[model samples]
Target chain A: MNPLSVVVRTICDIFTWFIGIFGIYIIIHGHMTPGGGFQGGAVVATMMAFLLVSHGGKKTLSFAKPGLYTAMETIGLLVFIGAGLFGITTTFFFNFLAGQGGVFGATVPIGPNSGVLNSAGTISIMNMAVGLEVIGGLSLIILYMFKGIRLFDNAAESGETGHDR
Target chain B: MKKRVLFMIAILVVAGTFWGALDNIHPFGDVPVAPMDDYYIENAQQERSVNNVVTAVVFDYRGFDTLGEAAVLFTAVCSVLALFRKGREGQ
Candidate 1:
C-alpha cells in the first residue's frame, strides 16, 4: 500500500507521541479520575492506526513486530491474573493492598477531596495491565488486517489465487 | 406496493416499541431508588481507597466481569490472527 502524502505523514509524526502520552496518563489516573485502561488503550491504539495509515504497511511493519505485541499481551494478562491471585489467601480479588501504607496503599479520606496518586492499590495495577493488553491487542488487529489485505494484492500480482488451495 | 406497506408497518412497530420503552424509562437522571449506588458511594472510599467510584466498581467490586471482558478481547485477537495466519506463513 502506498503511503499518504507528506503533509499527512508530517502531522501524524508530530502528534502520535502526544496521543500516546495522553493515553498513558489516562491509564495511570484511572483510580483517581474517570477514564480507565480500556478507554486509554483505545486512544493509544488510535495513534497506531494513524501511523499505519500514513506510513503504509511495510514501514509500519518494520517497526511493529506482531511477536512483540503478542508478548506484551501475554505479559499483561499474566500480571493482571497474578495481581488478582495475590489476595487469594483472603478472597479472590481482595483489596489487600489498600490502606496498608505501602506503594499504592494509602487510605483515601472518606469524603470528597482531591484524590491521591498512590492510593488505589490493586486497582491501579490492574488498570496498567489492561492498558497494555488493549494497546497490544488493538494494534495487532489493525496490523493483521493490513497484512492480510497486502497478501491478497501480492497473490494477485503473482498470478495465484488468494484463496486456499 | 405490498412490500412498501409491509415496510411501513415494520417501521411503525419498531418506532412504537422504542417510544413505549423510552416513556417507561426513569426521567433523565432521576432514579426512583438506587440502593446499590448509595452503598458503593458510601463504602468504596473505605473499601478500595479509590476516589473514582466507577473504577472501584469495575476493578474491585466487579473484577471478574473485567477479566471476562479481557478474555473476550483476547479471543477476538486470536481469531483475527488465526484468519491471517496464511498470509504471514506465505511470506
Candidate 2:
C-alpha cells in the first residue's frame, strides 16, 4: 500500500502520541469514569490504524513486532486471570483488596464525592489488564488483516502461473 | 405467486411479534423494579469501595462475565493469527 501525502504523515506523527495518551487516560480512569478497558483499548488501537493509514504497510509492519503484541496479549490475560484467582479463598473475583489500605485499596466515602484514583482494588487492575489485552488484540488483528491482503495478492499471482502449467 | 404470499406472511408475522413485544417493553429511561439493581446502586460503593457502580458490577459483582468476554476476544485474535501464519515464514 502506498503512503499517504506528506501532510497526512506529518499530522499522524503529531497526533499519534496524543491518541495514545487519551487511551491510557480512559483505561486508567475506568473505575471513576464512563470509559473502561475495552473502550479505551479500542481507542488506543486506533492509533495503530492511523499509523498504518499514513505510513503504509511495509513501514508499519516492519516497525511492529508480532512477538511483542503476543507477549502483551498473553501477559494481560495472565494478570487478569491471576487477579481473579488470587481471591479464590474468599470467592472468585472477590474484592479482597478493597479497603485493605494497599495499592488500589483506599476506601471512598459512600455517596457522591470526588473520584479516587487509588481505589477500586482489583477492578482497577482488571481494567488495566483488559486494556492491555485489547490494545494487543485489536492492533494484531489490524496488522494481520493488512498482511493478509498482500498475501492474497501474492497467492493470486502464483496461482495464475500454476493454472497455465 | 405462492412464494410471494409466504414472504408476506413471514414479514407480517415478524412485524406483529415486534409490535407485540414493544407493547410489553418498559418505557425508555423508566427502568422496571429490580432488587439486584437496587442493591448494586445502594451498596456497591460501601461493599466494593468503587464510586462507579457499573464498574463494580462488571469487575467485581459479575466479573465472570467479563472474563468470558476477554476470552472471546483472545480466541478471535488467535484465529486471525493462525489464518495469517501461512505466508509469514517466507517474510
* Clash list (residue pairs), candidate 2: none
Candidate 1 local lDDT, residue A20? 95
How far is B57's C-alpha from truth in model 1 (Å)?
A: 0.1
User: What is the Cα-based lDDT of residue B9 in candidate 1?
Assistant: 100
In candidate 2 chain A, where is summed lDDT lowest over 10 consecutive residues? Answer: A156-165
lDDT of 1 by residue, B1-91 (tens): 9999999999999999999999998888777698999999999999889999999999998998998998898999999999876644647
lDDT of 1: 0.88
Quote each prediction's TM-score: 0.85, 0.88
Give DockQ per model, in order: 0.69, 0.78
Query: Which parts of model 1 are misplaced by more than 4 Å?
Result: A150-152, A155-165, B1-29, B87-91
lDDT tens readout by residue for model 2, A1-165: 657789999999999999999999999999998989999999999998999888876688778988888888989999999999999999999988898888889999988988899999999999999999999999999988877775434644564221111
Query: Candidate 2: lDDT over CA atoms?
Result: 0.89
